[model samples]
Target: MKPLKTIIVMLLLLSISTYNCNAQDVKADVEKMHQLYIEMINNSNLENIDKLYTANASIRNSDATMINGLENIKNQYKATFDSGTFTISLETTDVSQLDDNHMFVSGTFVYSKTDEPKGVLKGEFVNTLKNVNGDWKILKSYRYLETTDNASIINSVYELFSKGDIPAVLALMDDEIVWNEAESNSLADGNPYIGPDAVLNGVFARIGERYKSFTLKDVKLHEMSNNQVLATLHYVLEMKNGKTYTIQAAHHWTLKDGKIVGFQQYADTKKLADSEKI
Candidate 1:
């Protein structure tokens, strides 16, 4: 009976030793495959992908749609690169080894375009690596695309305004406009300019009169909410008296139906008075 006990114990020990060895091998292989994947990406070699992926591998986009099969991945890549040239990079954050054969890798995908001032897209990604026949391969990969923040959109609106495209600037706002001013006369008159036409006539027309020519420079945009924006303007006003006055001002805006529904302006009254020589 004691001999039998010894044999059973030895078998269990052998099994544990084998498991650890296999786990170590898998870890090493996964690391090697990671480097190989990166090399393939840098080289832009799609042909070698078959060496790292199975015929039935799957990829899930940030939108949660699963694309299956090796050919599908190739097609997706082709379509994306064709639409716009891009260079993509990956950054791994958290990695969990599920077992000797499986792992979950969390990371980020950064994309850069050929265009100047290339916009950045930041998003999360997850990749599942599987060991098949002593080789590490990507079994499933997922990624999500990030959206631009409100500040960026508001800044873009100001850029459009600076170009003197009133229609283009107004197109970004809601139809029912609410315009306010800090001046005593405009405020005392209970003047809250509403709608597009009223805004163009009552408020925007007044702006033209204040300066022979006005240009916004070094403007800043802050998004108060998804539908509201506070645009801070640094403007140079060219006066009729052959002088230029610089003013810092802010405009609060609410948007509805892709148009400016509400607007409020704020500025230093003293500075404005000095500019107008009032």
Candidate 2:
């Protein structure tokens, strides 16, 4: 009985030690994977990228497109590298360990070329890592374009406005613009002012004609939960007829290809009408 008890004690200790060793191995593997990413980036090692990605790896973008297979992944990076000397900085976040073999990580990739003079190519990305046969591999990845956080589009528009750069401001508006003035009316003549020329000549120019100069004051951005942004602003306008009026407005804007494409304007229609009553 004493010998049997000794054997059981030995077995328990061995089991406990194995469990602890495995736990440490997992932590080490995570660190190793991160280091490998850094090494690959620093070397621009397009050749060894297959070692880091799975055979059937997939990359989905925030724009809702997917890239599949190792070749595609390699090609993607190759093109980017070929285009310019890519300087990429990666940050990992939301690293949730799904299991012993699966993990999810998300972060931003601040990309800049050694040649481009403008600001950096800023964006965010998310990745799913899976451990297969003792090696961690990127099973899936997703990337998205980063845009202005606090209605910077509107700010850009206002900058052009201050300069009285009408063409620059008009270029930001869509082909179809919603004036949002008529009561419950959605017609081109009523709610919307259709076509670029109509907006340029009819709306913006008319506003300009009324004002010798206008200055937007107290611009505020209100972002809705649905990703819609309202840029609320007030401005004082000195009329060509020597009249000054305070106008409050809301510019509802939507973005596409990093530019404003769809727009809705809400403001005091009476003030606009009163000024334009020729």
Candidate 3:
């Protein structure tokens, strides 16, 4: 009886060891697939790109554009390589085993053109890979470019404003923009300021006339779903009476066609108004 019990214990240990070995093998295969993907991109060759994806794989571009199927994916790569010379570097940040035959990987990538040395673009991506037969291929790829794009547009607005380029800032807005100022704030008097002209005349002009210096500080932008962006910032308003007001503020913006179409402001109105006192 004691001999039989010892044999059973030995068998259990072997099974556990085998399971661990299989997990390690899966990890190595997944890592190899990622390396192959990077190699295909760096090579800038469409022929090798086809080998990295399944027949029905889908890819989402940074600007929220979707490419479906292997043929279209090949075309996208062909267009990119044909456009100009660029090199991409990807660093894996996280990897998760979804199942015995699937994996999820996310990482940041940096891309730069050989000619445009100063024009480097960095973006993030998430990919899902499936084990087909004995090899792994990308099943779905989502690139987080919308975040960068929306942040860029918002930053440009602030830059233009700082440079006193009101016209340029207005140009970035839609023809029929819906701009809402914080409730109870002086600017809110013209709530839902429609159009670029209305925004310039109602909001900007009023602020210029009221405050000696109106500046935004510590600004942060967050990208949300459905083409929305949220900005958290602080307002530093210097009154003509030698008084100053610092108030927390937030701005919500909705954009389309590379133009801002909607804006909503949130701020401490009472704090801003009190600064007007001598």
Best by TM-score: 2
Q: Candidate 2, residue 63: CA error in Å?
A: 4.4
What range of 10 consecutive residues in model 1 has the weakest lDDT sum?
112-121
Residue 79 error, candidate 3, Å: 0.4
* Model 3 C-alpha lDDT per residue in residues 43-69, reported as the tens digit of each score: 776667666899999999876799999
TM-score of each model, paired residue for residue:
0.50, 0.53, 0.52
lDDT of 1 at 125: 76
**Cα lDDT for residue 265, model 3?**
94
For model 2 the local lDDT of residue 77 reads 76
The Cα RMSD in angstroms, rounded to one decimal, for candidate 2 relative to the true structure is 7.5
Top lDDT model: 3
> What is residue 112's positional error in candidate 1, in angstroms?
1.6
How would you order the candidates by lDDT, starting with the best? 3, 1, 2
The best-first sequence of candidates by TM-score reads: 2, 3, 1
For every candidate in turn, the CA RMSD to the true structure comes to 10.5, 7.5, 9.6
Off by over 4 Å in 1: 1-28, 145-148, 156-278
Q: Give Cα-based local distance difference scores for all models.
A: 0.70, 0.70, 0.84
